[model samples]
Target: MPKGYEMLPNGIIRIKSDNSMYDPWEIKKSQLDGEELTLIGRVVWAEQKM
Candidate 1:
């Protein structure tokens, strides 16, 4: 798992995209371990274009 990303108690991944304005994406825990999902890196800070 990358930085700032967390796994919930119910096996859900709580993650946010580079664009903070958009809603966070919740992925299943099993998906991360599968080939379907790839974790490259995480963005610590982002400046939204207004």
Candidate 2:
């Protein structure tokens, strides 16, 4: 998660997505527990590729 972001008790993490019409969506951290996900870097900014 980003700085100052809090993890929901339900384990749902909301992230911003410029590509999605939904914008913010819930993604349960529990769902990735078995996947062993890793954080490589933080995105400071982004631009749409068209």
Per-model TM against the reference = 0.45, 0.39
Q: What are the per-residue Cα lDDT tens digits for candidate 2 across 1-50?
A: 24223367887776554444435556688888778544344676867989
lDDT of 1: 0.66
How far residue 9's Cα lies from its native spot in candidate 1, in Å, is 1.0
After superposition on all CA atoms, what RMSD does each candidate show versus the true structure? 6.7, 7.1
Give the C-alpha miss distance for residue 1 in model 1, angstroms.
17
**Candidate 2: RMSD to truth:** 7.1
Reference-based TM-score, model 2? 0.39
Off by over 4 Å in 2: 1-6, 17-22, 34-50
lDDT of 1 by residue, 1-50 (tens): 23346778888887765555657778888866765545567566766989
Report backbone clashes per prediction.
Answer: 0, 0
